[model samples]
Target: MALLVEVHVPLTPTPGLPPGEYPFPWIEQVEDFLVDLEEEGAAESCDEGTTFGDYFVFFLVGATEAGLLAASSRVAALKGVPAGSFALVTDTEAPEMGTGRRVGLPL
Candidate 1:
């Protein structure tokens, strides 16, 4: 199963670091976590980007439920993380279809 792991952060984040630095701590935090998880094969694919003008969204795939929970916990525990900065894990599988164009497709 695939999961979309989202990490939302401020537009201009300065977590645990001063301003004017590249690779902001918040971004580095998630990337570092993914790097470790990737070594363990807990995560295989990820797409990180910004959104809503107030957030940096991370879309991850191939993570187990427990793995995602662990990652979320880590993100939640980071120092200097803003209140609005949070993590969310969701299943990425397509929903079962009972109508529309999916009605006639083979399972």
Candidate 2:
């Protein structure tokens, strides 16, 4: 019933913003969203993944498919979030699924 939501956020500097500005403000928004998810019993765990030079990845577990999609959409609508920002929805318990390959289309 729960799904894995993989969030990929770009860390590139936004034009017209101050130096060293965080390109994606949606990250905080997503964190807040996760809090709501927890309150609603839709989130089991959330973890910040290793950050590469240009982007960062985070994982969320125990989210309903609809909830994850809605949260991802909200993050994509936030200001200062780059176009590269996206979320991958995956069903880890689905039959015929590969070994660690549950990424869905970008959100």
Candidate 3:
């Protein structure tokens, strides 16, 4: 199973630092939180990466139900991050197998 977790983080530019500094600390915090959940049998594997922008974005992939739950909990906890802002979303399974279609006109 594959689960995609999207995180949107708000960032404020520092006086001397570059605009949108690395969210390493926030990342570390998230990683640590996820690791703890994994240790508690709440996750299978967690792969995290970042995207650049005025707001930080994080993508996490998990391979199990526990993993998904862990990811969700971690994201929820980030609501209080002192950063500029934050948002999180998780992928859900389709109602039917291979029954969903993309809504768009094929060019």
Candidate 2 C-alpha error for residue 102, in Å:
8.4
User: How many pairs collide in each candidate, listed in order?
Assistant: 0, 0, 1
lDDT per residue for candidate 3 within 5-104, as digits (tens), equals 4445545433444667763455566566667766776553334545555555545454453455455556545634434433333443534221222111
lDDT of each: 0.55, 0.60, 0.47
Please estimate how well model 3 matches the true structure, expressed as its whole-model Cα lDDT: 0.47
Error (Å) of candidate 2 at residue 95 is 16
Query: Which TM-score value belongs to model 3?
Result: 0.46
Instruction: Give the candidate order by descending lDDT.
Output: 2, 1, 3
Name model 2 segments beyond 4 Å from true: 20-26, 40-45, 91-107
lDDT of 2 by residue, 14-101 (tens): 6776777766555676567667767877654465554655666666676566776666555556666666766666655545222233
Q: State the weakest 10-residue window (summed lDDT) of model 3.
A: 98-107
Candidate 3, residue 24: how far the Cα is off, in Å:
5.8
lDDT of 1 at 8: 57
Better of 1 and 3 by lDDT: 1
